[model samples]
Target: MNLFKLFQDIEAVDGDATERLGYYSRRSLLRLGSKALAVSAPTVMASVLNEAYAQSSSVQDVLNYALTLEYLEDDYYQKGNAAANLIPAADKAIFTQIGKHETAHVALLRGALGSAAVAKPAFKYPAATFTDYQTFLLLAQAFEDTGVRAYKGQAGNLLGMDVLTTALQIHSVEARHASEVRRLRGLRGWVSATDEAPAPVYAGEAVTSQAGVDLVALTGKSADRVREAFDEPLDRAAVLAIAQPYL
Candidate 1:
């Protein structure tokens, strides 16, 4: 929750981060960061965040975009958790906890958007998505991975605002969900460049450099190791392409 370091990291990834963070200059962003750092009165912090997001039509669109994904995940987990024999008893707790997080995320994003929130759409899945454990695991892996990348892709759109902090927190949870799902599927906790089974979900993940720094060269690590160390963001168009089947 280091606000200053968070802003610095965002700028490192996307140099124009502050410019899009409520149209603020570096000075204004630092001032906001200082306020967020102080952890003063709750109302004062709330007012600052409201000012950052309440007036932006663009932020509303981002929230709605996020809501769609949450609704999809929430519905998926609800049906899975309710199914009599879908999830194995031993892993029921894991999925149940995951489902609750999704539901809470849906509520949080929906409340923020209020009237502007997008209505939940009917979710569709492959045959035996829940009835078969292996199928269920596969689909969960894909959904969770897509969710993580999708959130990271939206980070630049929500830079200096406190909402960005909120998004990052959710992003962290999504990543844990992805890692757990991947491990259940017998893969490592991280995505591999060769894991393109679900087509473009793992596509474009083979990069070796980030922020103009060659990670492999800098760290003296193998290319695959370097690739596994950093996550690649998926643009909205790419994420929607992957999400189309579920909506």
Candidate 2:
């Protein structure tokens, strides 16, 4: 599909009742709170999105697919933090901060989409292959790294400047989370040594299409490819399939 059409499709599926499920929007928050927080401006200016135009049949599967990942990350950290022994005392504080940040992100995205935000499907991630704390860190490193990239990958498909900007904001934070996790894992830096270090990039920030660049290049992958690695944008059904096993 062409880019705009793709975005519209994602937006359409994202608007359905199944996606909204149990959420209630206080119009007060929808107006005043969202503006104070700068949530509504981008989508409104770019897409002219309104509740009337949004329908369940019109929701975009890709958007919901992306939302599912955010839910997964938010829930993972929430649950992960509760496992007292899972995180080191020194790191627990920061881990909770990241968890809270992810929580806010999910909430922010949901609010921006209004009722179009998809439901959090019951999910269970595949059993982590790690056997030790360090190993788990490695997995954590991978997950955060993947998150940083995934957000970037999806940004282009978003038409509303407001939605794009908000997504970009979250994307940068995810990068920070990735860097911190990498450091904890004893990795030299967030980016591979051959790649630039400490620089953050996002999918919504720019548009580029490259495949498997991270795997092929020593410079680590560009921020955008991290999103692409997960492959095509997923619809609701596809997202639930992957996430269901995790829940």
Best model per TM-score: 1
Q: Report per-prediction Cα RMSD to one decimal.
A: 9.9, 13.7
The lDDT for every candidate, in the order shown, is 0.80, 0.56
- Give per-residue CA lDDT, model 2, range 43-153, as digits (tens): 543333344234323324445556777887887777677765777888888888988998988887676555667898664544552224565565555556656666666
Candidate 1, 112-139: lDDT as tens digits? 7667678999989888988999988888
Please report how far candidate 1 places residue 181 from its true position, in Å.
0.8
Measured on C-alpha atoms, candidate 2 has an lDDT of: 0.56
Residue-level lDDT for 143 in candidate 2: 54
TM-score of each prediction: 0.78, 0.55
10 residues in a row with least lDDT, candidate 1: 9-18
Question: Which pairs clash (backbone N, Cα, C closer than 3 Å) in model 1?
Answer: none
* TM-score of model 1 vs. true structure: 0.78
